[model samples]
Target: MKEKATLIVVGTPTKILDSYEKQHAPFTKYKFHLSKVYKGDGEEGTEIELLQDGNKDASYNVHPLMEVGEKYILFLERSSTGALIMVGGPAAKYKYNKEEKVFESIDGGRIDEHLERK
Candidate 1:
C-alpha cells in the first residue's frame, strides 16, 4: 500500500477543519502536524491537510476518523484535486499505541507484519 501512496507520514491530528459533502459523499478535512516522514517528501513539524472520507459524526461514518493529538501513520495519495487522501480508506491508516510503541490498524486489522518490513 505504501508503494502506491504519494506520501506516507507519521503525524498527529491537530484539528478538524471542515465537514462537507463532495460528490455526494461526506468528507472531513483534518490538519495534521507531521512528526516523521517514512516515505515521500515531507518534513518533520510540517503541517499537512488530509481529506478523509466521512463526516464529524461517527454514527454515520463507515470509517473511524482520527482523534486529535493521537499519533498516526498514514498512507496517502493525491486525489484528483490534489488533496491528500488515505490510499485504502481505513485500511491504510494506523494509530500508534504509545505504551506498546507500535502501530495498530484503525479498523482492527492486523498489519504488524506489513509494518515490520518498513
Candidate 2:
C-alpha cells in the first residue's frame, strides 16, 4: 500500500483545492518533485522547475510555474475514516543541477504522464 499523508490529489481537481484545505485545517505544506502539470487537458502541460526546497507558488517565470520556497507546496492529509484526501497539485518537476542553482526541466522526459499512466 502507498504511504498515507494527511491529504492527496488524484487525477486533478481544480475546484476541489479550497475544499481540501478547509477540511485539513491549520493547513500544512507538502513538497514533491513536481513531476507534471495538467491544464485540465489530456496532453502534458508545461513543466516547472524543481527545487530541493521551495514554494509551489509565487510566479517567477513568464510561464505559470510555482515558486520554490516552503509555503507554496501542497500538503496531504488523512481523513478520520483513514482515507487520504488530496490537498493540492504540486509544482512541475525540473532537473536539479548541483552546479547550477536554477531549477529547470530535462530535455524531453515527463514524469506526471508516467505517474498517471501507471
Candidate 3:
C-alpha cells in the first residue's frame, strides 16, 4: 500500500543521528514524515503521491527541505561537513484527513502532489 508524509518541519540545521560523531544533519530541513501519517516504515519515507510525470523516484522537487512561501525562510547554511543546514521555522506537522482521502501536512508535505512541485 502507498502512503504520504504528514509533517515536514524546517528546523535549525541540526545533526542527524549517525554513528561515530554527532554532526549537523545534511539536509537543509528536518522533515518529519510520520509513519502514523503514512502507514509506512522507519526506513523508507512515507510514500509520496506520484506526480503526473509517472516518475516514482523518492526524490522530488517538492523536497520539504525547500522553504515554502518565502525564500529566506528555508535558506541553507553550510555546515562543518559542507552539509546544508536549515534555518528559520519550517516546522510543520499534519494528520491524515480521511475525509479528504489524503495526508495533510500541518507544516508542509501532503498536498496536491499530483499537481504541485517545487
Candidate 4:
C-alpha cells in the first residue's frame, strides 16, 4: 500500500514552508513551478502547493524533498481539499537533471525512459 499514486508532474520546487493544522500538527507545504505535466492536466505556468504531513510519528509516509530551486519528477495523490501530496514517500520522488536530460531516483538509479516528455 505504500506505492499508491495517481498523478505525476515535473516541476521545480519554488518555495516551502512549515505550518500546522487545526490541532497544531505540523505539515510541510511546497510550492512548485510546474514545467511538464506528465499525467494530469498539461497546463504549465501555474504554481501549485503540495502538502505533506510533517509529524513523523504518525505521518502518511511523507518524506522531505525540500530542495527549493531543484527540478523533480513527483508522484502525487490529491487530497480532499484539492491539494497534492507526495505518494509512497521517497520512492515517489525523482531528481531531474535538465543538463544531462536524465531522471535520478532516490536510490541512485538513472531513469531515462518510460516517462512521457511534454
The model with the greatest lDDT is 1
lDDT of 2 by residue, 1-118 (tens): 0133332222222121211133323222323333233222222332221122222333224223333331122234445554332332233333333354333332332233223310
Query: How do the residues 13-87 of candidate 1 rate in per-residue lDDT, one tens digit apiece?
Result: 999999888678888899999988878888898999998888865323446878899988889999989999999
**Compared with the true structure, what per-residue lDDT tens digits does model 3 show for residues 42-108?**
2233322111111222223533432222211122233445443322223222223446644344255
Candidate 1 has what TM-score? 0.86
TM-score of 4: 0.69
**Residue pairs with backbone overlap in model 3:** 10-90, 14-25, 15-24, 15-25, 92-107, 93-106, 93-107, 94-106
Better of 1 and 3 by lDDT: 1
Candidate 3 local distance difference test against the native: 0.28
Q: How high is the lDDT of residue 68 in model 3? A: 24
Candidate 2, residue 82: the lDDT equals 45
lDDT of 4 by residue, 1-118 (tens): 1236666778888887555564666677877888877676646778888876663344443355457898887788877777787776666777876787888765665665356432
What TM-score, computed on C-alpha atoms, does each candidate reach?
Answer: 0.86, 0.21, 0.21, 0.69
Q: Better model by TM-score, 1 or 2?
A: 1
Stretches of model 4 off by over 4 angstroms after superposition: 1-4, 21-26, 53-62, 80-82, 98-100, 113-118
Among all candidates shown, the one with the greatest TM-score: 1
TM-score of 3: 0.21
